[model samples]
Target: MVFEKDPTSLYQIYPTTVAVIGARYGDELNFMAAAWHTLLSFNPPIFGVSISPKRYTHDLLMKSGEFTASFLGHGHAELVEKLGRTSGSKINKVLEYGLELLEPRVVKVPGIGNAVAVYECRVLESRSYGDHTFFVGRIVGLHYDPRAFDEVGRPAYDPVLYLGKDVYVKIDRSRTIEFDPEKFRK
Candidate 1:
């Protein structure tokens, strides 16, 4: 195997869940599919979504100070792709796609009705990192489909995983393995 110092094409982490970031400012609402998002902290329940400055959602996020990270199942891959490719600035994606939005509990932004899990967050901070701005948010509310998650919070349903370059995949639960670190104790 060979490796390069430049990390331009290093998208090794391909199977990450696609996070549909929803933001609203007044009557304007937008949802963008983001492959670059993760849980920042557990103590204060913080989440972060890396969005480019040119995205319409970025402007709404800054003005609203709140957003929702909605995780959809594998069945919605087509919808996710549509959301990622289109720009909210040019058209109303929600109306065009006929997306059903759920009423938010804590934040002003609503989540996709079909989402398996949605995290309603209030903006904590935003900082520039390269071409994207990392928006850190404190989780204010959580909505999850109980049927989609196991008792220990493991995903029971196939989740939409982005593989970059317009590709998508899902988990095969039949191949899942449970590993215990205690067995490897020195």
Candidate 2:
């Protein structure tokens, strides 16, 4: 198997906005928006989210060792940017944005209700990689709006996707296509 240099440009990957909710170390609570989140496993339900040490939310997650991943819903593009740009050490991002919070059953950190889905997670492991730390969490509790669930029980909420440098997108679920490696690689 061969691969080219790191060509995973911003245009190459579909983006999703995630609200990282956790308790601050000393006091207070914090929830920051993140774009670097992905599912790592399904059996134990684990997710991988990368956070920079400079981010105030990072310190909180590190201290509590638990957090929530809340998916952003429509009309939330501006809120995501606002939370990502501001520092919780100086300002209360949740209160500033008028975001509603819900107490999770397993964690002290609250989950954002604005999102279609919220995964209440406990940190299973953390590893520092380069300029950021990646946290692997196991999902302990999950919540979502029933209206956002489709007839098939899948989430129907259209997630707001982040494009590098400041662009937002929503999933075009109607445009899915089946792929065949042999047909396209030749």
All candidates: CA RMSD in angstroms?
A: 2.4, 4.8
lDDT of model 2, residue 98: 83
* Candidate 1 lDDT over residue span 49-112, tens digit each: 8999999999999898999999999999999999999999999999999999989999989999
| Native-to-model Cα distance after best TM-score fit, residue 98 in candidate 1, in Å | 0.3
| Model 2: pairs clashing at backbone N, Cα or C within 3 Å | none
Cα TM-score of candidate 2: 0.82
Off by over 4 Å in 1: 1-8
Task: Report clashes for each candidate as comma-separated counts.
Answer: 0, 0
After superposition, the stretches of candidate 2 with alpha carbons farther than 4 Å from their true spots are 1-11, 17-19, 173-186
Q: Identify the candidate with maximal lDDT.
A: 1
- Best prediction by TM-score: 1
Any residue pairs clashing in model 1, and if so which? none
